[model samples]
Target: MVITYIAGPISGNIDINKQAFLNAADQLQSSGRVVLHSASLPVGLTEPQYMDICFAMIRACNEMVMLPGWRQSTGATAEYYYAKKIGVVVRDFNQTLKVSR
Candidate 1:
């Protein structure tokens, strides 16, 4: 199965962004897609720490599904570029899923 990682903003509005990530995950799962994400990262981690884990998670996936407004997120933007760099399929939730890499 090609696992898809959920990427979105989580710093300024953690609750809302996490919900968005979870919603994205649920939608993908309903379509029988396996998902990889760290929306529920362990507590007390710094921004870099969270991204460290997120980056590792993305490496394990075959694709990445970026949430709306991902470009405004430092982390999600990085994830999108990284996915392209490593050849992971990139798609957007704001529009129909299309390969960007």
Candidate 2:
């Protein structure tokens, strides 16, 4: 099974954004992929610290699932590039699902 980390805009719009992340995770899990994501956004943490966590998860995973609107997020874009730099496969979650179907 492919291990995947979820990356997307998550700084604001907590309810909506978290749901999108969860949905992406569910979709990937159903497709037989192991998914890693920050399911809980801690109450107080520096951006760099949070990014470190994200990067660590990405490193542990073999692939990354970029949720919709990933381009709008600086963090998501960083994650995408980092994955590329580390040779981790990156997939647009929705697009990947469409092609799989």
Candidate 3:
């Protein structure tokens, strides 16, 4: 399975953006596509634990999807750059066409 790590903005009062990513993950999952999302991170997790969780997710995934508004997030931007540097298949969610469709 090719796990796609979904990276995007998670800060500020952006519940709608957060939900959008979750909805995207749901849609992908419904089609049997493997997708990882940061929203799965527990609220108020310790810094080290958060880093561990994110690293684990990135290591487990074969590729990454920069969710819409990812550019607005500092962490997401850094992850995008890292993914590119490491040769992970990074793509923009808005530009991708669903193969399962």
Candidate 4:
């Protein structure tokens, strides 16, 4: 089974950001992939601390699914580049789901 990390904004409009992550996680799981969702991480940590946690999770995943608005998120953008640097497949959430379906 493939392990996929869900990456997106978590700072602005947190509710919407979390919902987007959950929706993508559900979709990916339904497609038989294991999902590592950052939104599931505990809140209140400093940005650097959160990124540290997220980077560790990303390193464990086989792929990354970047949600809409990811471009606007510093963390998500960093994840994207890190995934690329480490050779983890990076995919658009909508495009990946459509292809899987």
Candidate 5:
């Protein structure tokens, strides 16, 4: 099974971010892909700490699925670039969903 990391904004409107991640993760799981979403990251961690954890998860995944508004997030952007640097497949959430559906 393909392991996909879900990267998106989490600083602003956390509820919306969490919901979006959950919905996308559900769809991805239904399609038989293993998902690593950051929505459940422990609260109260510093930005650097969060990124450290997220980057580790990214390294473990086979690919990354970037959600809409990811460009506006520093953490997501870092994940994107890191994934590129390490040759991990990077996909857009909408495109992945379209292909799966």
Candidate 6:
């Protein structure tokens, strides 16, 4: 299966928007891909613990499908940059549709 990390904005009003992103992720997961979803993480974690899990999640995935607000969050943007630095296939939601079609 293609391991996919689903990245999205996860700060501030994350509690409000994350559910929508997870819905998208659920559809992606139906394809039999392993999806690394932030929703899977426990809430209210320390900064370092969160970062550690995020990094580990990124390392385990083959690619990333970053959601619309990814760039709006510092941590999500950093995750994108780190994924690129590590040579992981990183596709924004816009880019994904271009190829998926």
User: What tens-digit string does per-residue lDDT give for candidate 3 at 35-97?
Assistant: 887787768877557656776788778878788788888778877887787778887776554
Name the lDDT value of residue 77 in candidate 2. 95
Q: Rate the local accuracy (lDDT) of all candidates.
A: 0.81, 0.87, 0.77, 0.91, 0.92, 0.81
- Residue 78 of candidate 5: its Cα lDDT? 94
Per-residue lDDT over 1-101 for candidate 6, one digit per residue giving the tens place of the 0 to 100 score: 68888888877786676885787677677767778877678888997788789889899998899888777888788889989999889988657656654
Every model's TM-score: 0.88, 0.91, 0.84, 0.97, 0.96, 0.87
lDDT of 6: 0.81
TM-score, model 1 to reference: 0.88
lDDT of 1 by residue, 15-53 (tens): 888888888888787777788887878779887898889
For candidate 5, the per-residue lDDT at 67 reads: 95
Clashes of each: 0, 0, 0, 0, 0, 0
In model 1, how large is the Cα lDDT of residue 8?
80
- Model 2, span 1-101: residue lDDT tens: 78989999987787899999988888888888888987566758888988999899999999888888889999999999999999998988877798656
**Among these predicted structures, which one has the highest lDDT?**
5
Query: Which stretch of 10 consecutive residues in model 1 shows the poorest summed lDDT?
Result: 92-101
Model 4 TM-score (2 dp) = 0.97
**Model 5, TM vs. native:** 0.96
Find the number of clashing residue pairs for candidate 5: 0
Candidate 1 off by > 4 Å: 96-101
Residue 26's lDDT in candidate 6: 76
Candidate 5 has an lDDT of: 0.92
Rank by TM-score, descending?
Answer: 4, 5, 2, 1, 6, 3
